[model samples]
Target chain A: MAEVRLTTPISEEEIRKLKAGDTLYLSGKMFLARDEAHLRAIEMFDEGKELPFDFKGLAVFHCGPIVKQDDTGQWHVVAAGPTTSSRMEIFQDEFIERFRVSVVIGKGGMFERTTAAMKKYGCVYAAFTGGAAVLAADGIKKVEGVEWLDLGTPEALWIFEADNFGPLTIAIDSHGNNLFKDIADIAEKNRPKAYEIIGASKE
Target chain B: MEFAPIIEKVAFNLMKYSATVLPDNAIKAIKTAYEKEKSTTGKAQLGAIIKNFESGAEKSTPMCQDTGIHIYYVEIGADCPIDDLGKFREALTNASRKTTTEVPMRPNAVDPFGSNSGDNTGRYIPWINWEIVSGDKIKITAFPKGGGSENMSTVKMLKPGVGLTGVMKEVVDWMISAGGQPCPPTVVGVAIGGGADIAIKIAKKQLMRPIGEPHPQKEVAEMEQKLLKAINTTGIGPMGLGGNITSLAVHMDYAMRHPASLPMAIAVQCWAARQSAAEISADGKVKYLHHDIKD
Candidate 1:
């Protein structure tokens, strides 16, 4: 679990070396999609419709960002931060396999199904600070464009051309290591102790 | 007489401020936690959060993509016209519409049957609550609550005698179970005394209080401190990566309730639980406030 700098079109060999808790900065292009968009993407895939963007070896951020457009119809990213990943857990494993995304960026961690997918599909789950929207945006070089505007801003698909876009930590890495579960174990051990503090309050 | 224009303008500014600026107290609490955090991941999360606040301010960008739902608390003077309340409400709705575009906020309000406003205005959105004050001035505070934290808010109703200990344990257990989904070191807001719904509303409201600002009641203040300590001890830490400061602060506010029931509510706010306040005088001159910014 060491800090690693990775640029994508990430090869299988590069991802397999990473473990949970490693700091990873991804320099490349990516796009954002939330729960609704994922559902749409899945349905679209099933129906054999044209998807808005190709997903192979790219990063998918779980975000619905605040974006603005100038008079010329160009887009600007006001703030782009990761959403809680667990909300997308249902669609994530399928997304990893169907999209073949090399990196998945979001926060609050994913569960066993996603960990298994990351292992099996050569993907890594990156945790970005949940509310660090503008800091996250600072890493973006351009908003290439957006799609699925019908989904609304918080759920729209915003395709971004980004470079070194992260302070993203690999919370669940390619090898099936899960940072959130490990932390949860420690917290579980401490819970009974914390409950004792509450009981002491009765006195 | 005509306070509509002023209300619209002030509300617009407040929403923008809430989205762009991290209440100074929240920033301070995060900095303090960053210093004391032991886990490298937790510390890095805190550091990224601090950077986010700074960048959001400098760029006047919405801090988090959620931009959450905006909750407004308005204080009005006794002398204000009774007929003007309707005008005030309209202004709130208008201001919310403008802010959605001006702040370039994400369209967050979708109706139950699955239709969004495209702008964030719905009937009750940019929800406003009113309080009557003695003086002839209007004060407004905006809390731009994000979705992630709001999802974790919980309420438990206990038999009246279940007591303070039961409330504390409920909060701790919730925090432990939450395990960073709300984004730690979160601000934990507890509301006790009212019926279940009111308690939940008050708990969400109290999340606006700055970190380290103690509850006014002596006993509640003690409980706040204790709850903060116990929750942190669980090692949920920042983003639940594990560290020393899981919760930056625990705040509680209460309302009188019936003797037979105890309703306790806890609301969690992410570190960027953006809030800002300002006031407009009778003459319609508006002034933004930061005295509540805090240590």
Candidate 2:
């Protein structure tokens, strides 16, 4: 796995090289958004209206973080951990295609539709640790801006510049491989033996 | 003496405590998992989660942004003095507001049709399960269950002949399909041999067991270990990023069942499995009972 640093304006090619199991240390600008923002984006797109920001080559993080302000009025992320990505599965493909998003950062693996979208659109789905919000916050160099305050802090869009932002692994690669499904398959194969053990123990 | 009011108070308190205590377990488990994790990325992720929990606790913040829905399982003593159960409900509703402000749990309860209850308590804000026991002390266990994990729970009824093999197949299959979706690595709770509702209750109760603690029954203990090993072989690993530790534990609770009906339930507890217990005595004394809480 190659360790590459990403900046605000990344290329689809940069994302295509990533595969399931590859790791990345992302840098530069990234946007935070979740269920609400996704719905809003979809609405705007369907209405054929202009979006608040450009979406091409952008990275969207599936997170609703708990942030705190320190003594200096500087905001520190208390828990900026990733949310479950599969919940976004329904909208992910359309979101990627319409927005030209290169990387989708979140926890958990995306579904088949998302993996297919990744391969077709030259994108990748990378997973940061689900519960590791504090470490994720440490990757942020600055908070560039914010928007959509009506959704509240957790649901609002916060723009941040991060340095070496991840040890994130590719859960869905450009080749359409999904780590989540593969693991499930392995677990299924050994299930019978597993039952026998449990049965024997009961005796 | 009515019992409803006291039951309500107990339910409310359970919800509050469940939300507040999640970070401790999440941090502890992540740190331990990191040290033992075989995969490099998994180790790194575990380390990050540990740091997050530390900061969340140190700052007195909720470990996760999703404070989750309030769910409580309560056992009331037969001899306990409770004049009004409705008062208990009122107390729970009132306590929910206090806990929301104190623990600062995210206001998650909403009216099904519309409208948000900013205080986190509303009609049925804290879901309650009640049981009457013979003792003079009331015990309450609270689980601040996240939607993600709750969505992954599964229930099935097998023919008696299908036996333990059927149970293992169904449980492991569900977990595999749930990989990373329920936020692996997770702790799985299995309840077998009870009626549908009771099976579900037992499954959730199994989650209260401490991580790595073996079940008291030798057979159950072996099943737990076998399932754990089988799940890890999936390579779903930590955080679904792929690793050796897919599950930290598998706990099960069983019950006697009908001759022909073998019902089972699997409740998935995310890595952030937060639970705490409390007991109230006849004299109105209260005690916090939890795995980590010390006197």
Per DockQ, the best of the predicted structures is 1
lDDT of 1 by residue, A19-82 (tens): 8877888887788989988999899998999897788888899988888889999998888888
- Residue A108 lDDT, candidate 1, scale 0-100: 92
Q: DockQ of candidate 2?
A: 0.42
What lDDT would candidate 1 get against the real structure? Answer: 0.84
What is the RMSD of candidate 2? 4.2
lDDT by residue (B238-277, candidate 2, tens digit) is: 7776677788888987999988899999998888787777
DockQ of every candidate structure:
0.75, 0.42
- The runs of at least 3 residues in candidate 2 whose Cα sits more than 4 Å from the true structure, single-residue gaps closed, are A17-20, A27-29, A67-78, A140-164, A175-177, A181-203, B1-36, B291-295
Clashing residue pairs in candidate 1, if any? none
Best by TM-score: 1
> Interface Cα RMSD per model, in Å?
1.2, 3.0
Q: Provide the DockQ value for model 1.
A: 0.75
